[model samples]
Target: MGKIPKNRDEALWTLAEWNLSKPEWQHFYSPQLKSDMMIRIAKEWKLDGVMLHYNRGCEGLSLGIAENRLAIAKAGIPVMTFEGNMGDEREFDEARTMDRIDAFMETMGLKRELLHA
Candidate 1:
């Protein structure tokens, strides 16, 4: 893993390692602003899908599951939520996760071939 930067400038420099250019820099810097920007990018790139992780541990930072689902659906893409605790094995229930994913795929009419690998 790369070292976490101590400040914003150092963080931007570190992002350069991932080939992110200065013109594209603003997107990485501000996440609250990034959602709308990403919706625009999705349309511009002709993307067929979007996913939002309604993470358990990071619930404070994440848009709540209902709103996230609504936003993605409004963008005309299928959205699914998987509940998993970051870095906590005890909180990650694989069976429940798979069930939610399966139900979501079924409701969205996603083919088993497309979803199951």
Candidate 2:
């Protein structure tokens, strides 16, 4: 505050003062913030499904990923959570990832239409 408020009712705050007026500085801390943002983005862009990534090494980000996936799926769209590590080659498995992706697509009513003879 520029100065102490003269009275309890004199408090005034602006988004700029809270450092939330900038795109990079703004974030929603609400319980459903992440889920809401994802749903909104998908709806706004007319997305069919959501593929969420889960990095094994990042505990903080990986935490509650299952809950997040459930919330996203509750938005009436298919959601997929793929497990992998950013820089760990051992965690990267093409066959498993592709299989999961294929299964997710099938659950979303999508089929692999291309066939090689």
Candidate 3:
């Protein structure tokens, strides 16, 4: 098949493989790796930021967004999340989403210019 990652430990494995040392694995095997790998990839591609859908219905998935947010923030990246159902626009509050986004961006200094630029 395609080229496999040289480090198998970094490859996505079962949840059992993810243990108390997950952060250690990330730091050693792939320092670039994070819970927000998708957002990190988008940022590496020079995108402005990442918008995560924090679905209220998906409790398991949404539970880790806060940790992911913290990790992404440590990487000097911006993330904005909105609370809503997967396919129900009626449940999406635009104003609240905008408020969160604005606050996140501000906190990340996304609106600031580079000191040298």
Q: Residue-wise lDDT of candidate 1 within 1-117, one digit each (tens)?
A: 269899999888787755542325434454424455556667898766665565667645454445545655777876666667775768888898778777777776776678877
TM-score of each candidate? 0.53, 0.67, 0.50
Tens-digit per-residue lDDT, 1-117, candidate 3:
234545656455434356523654443344234464655576779866677777877665565666676677676666677789765778889888777876767676755243224
lDDT of each: 0.63, 0.69, 0.62
Lowest summed-lDDT stretch of 10 residues in model 2?
A: 22-31
Clashing pairs in 2: none
Residue-wise C-alpha lDDT for candidate 2, range 1-117, written one tens digit per residue: 357667645544542344543323323333255666677788999998999888887665655566668878888978888889876869978899888888877777777563111
Error of 3 at 19 (Å): 16
Count of backbone clashes for each model? 0, 0, 0
* Models ranked on lDDT: 2, 1, 3
Residue 78, candidate 2: alpha-carbon lDDT: 82
Candidate 1 vs candidate 2: the lDDT winner is: 2
